[model samples]
Target: MTKEWMNWYRETLLIDAHNDVVSKMKDGGLDFCQRQSATHSDLPRLLEAGVNLQVLALFAPPDSNKSVTLQRILSYAEYALDCVDRDPRLHLVLTKRDLEALSPAEGKLGVILGVEGGDCVGEELWILRLLYRLGVRLLTITWSNRNALADGIWEKDTRGGLTSFGKEVIKEMEALGMIIDVSHLAPAGFWDIAEVAAGPFIASHSNAAAVCPHPRNLSDEQIRCVADRGGVVGVNFYGPHLTEFGSASIDDIIRHIEHLWNVAGEDHVGLGTDYDGMDIVPRELEDVTCLPRLVEKLRQRGHSESRLEKFMGGNFLRVFKTVLPD
Candidate 1:
């Protein structure tokens, strides 16, 4: 890596828009404070990668009982809160001011809770309010399955948009200053969100289907729409999303970033590694500690220091300032 790239990375506040480490932490009875080979992230690995902020997803798997699933999510939130309380190095950021006060120089890592599926809310707006009270700042409308709020990517046959309840939920979330994430919402639902969102939204962990033809990936038009709405599209690093082939490398990731940049503009693109959520990752970027390797490659591609800074995290920071509650 060039000295310029190294210095820029060191000075900038790098953030990953999405990570599923908390799920693994809870499922395996693992501790976030200790390094484990079982997951793609740990506290030490985050520090090593210079990650100033991370959004930990609170995901609930599909099951028969919605109440039980929500209870499990609550347990996860408690675990995350307990972790933050015990670790001086970790800070849970609930508002814009908290994020602004984060000090990487002091070795503090800013953590934000994001609910990956609105199904966890269980058709109750009050439950959504409860999650906000519990410190969840980002909410994905759906997660590859139909929910009371809307359809996910896999529910294409329905071609349904947000339900009546979904519209109310969006308005309420916006009023509460909670960010609406569109990563797994269906194509019709994506447009529905665009029509209703008064402020920016994000695709926390998605890639360009134009680059890799996965149904899970966003189309070029979707990427452009995200940028047009003054939001950010975090380039996903999962192998299947990065390429048609099962295996992907850092170069494939770079290709997605390049395509996103070309379509979404530099200010609207960011990184959302989706670590621990995927079974396969790019060989070079096997874990959080290898983030710098991608930076080095971007430098080799001649991305200016300013552009690189935005891609690293500035874009999301800007959105946070705009959308986070004062």
Candidate 2:
């Protein structure tokens, strides 16, 4: 990498909207504070990659009962807190002020807690409130299955959208300053959210369906809707989402970014590499430290410094600033 891009990358406020390291910690006893050769990211690797902010997801298997799911989420939250407490360089981000306090030069990794599915919320708004009080600032309404809130991408046969409860939950989330993630929501549910949401929302870790034709990827219209709402579509680095053949490399990642740039505009593009959440990742992007290579490739593709900055992290920071509480 050239010195110019490297310097620019270091100075930029890099943010990833989604990661599953917390769940990995909960289930596999993965150490977040130490460098782990088995996982995609850890404290040392994230610092080396220059990631200023990382949103760790609290996810439970969709099939688990409400009680089990709630317990699992709480356990993950506790573990994440423990990890933060164990590492002086890691801080939990709760408000806009906390986010603004992050500086790449300080080598502090600010963590924003989020939930990958709303099943833990069950039919109660208080559970959601509890999560907020616990420092969860983002929630994805569904995973890949139907829940009390709405149907997921795999529920297309049902043609289900948001339940009345789902609409209420979203309104409550916005009022509580929690970001709404629409990554695994079905098309019907995605449109329902667009209709009900009064503020910007994000597809936290999804790619472009127009490029890879995967259910987990968003369509051009979906991308446009997110951009129109002043929201962002985080490019997912998972292989299947990036290529039809289920194998991908850095070039495939660039293809998705290019498509998102054209369809969603520069302001709506960001990185949400679902690291530690997937089994397979794109070649050359096997871990967090490879992020600079991705940016270098974009630079080679003629992306100007300002545009590359947006794609790298600026877009998500703008949305977080807008959506997160003061």
C-alpha lDDT values of all predictions: 0.90, 0.92
Measured with C-alpha atoms, the lDDT of residue 4 in candidate 2 is 74
Instruction: Residues 77-170, candidate 2: write the lDDT tens digits.
Output: 9999998988899999988998788887578899999999999999999999999999999999999999999999999788999999999999
Task: Score every model by TM-score.
Answer: 0.98, 0.98
Residue 244: error of model 2 in Å?
A: 1.0
Q: Write the per-residue lDDT of candidate 1 for residues 194-254, one digit (tens) a residue.
A: 9998999999999999888898899989999999999999988888898888799999999
Clashing pairs in 2: none
Root-mean-square deviation of every model: 1.1, 0.9
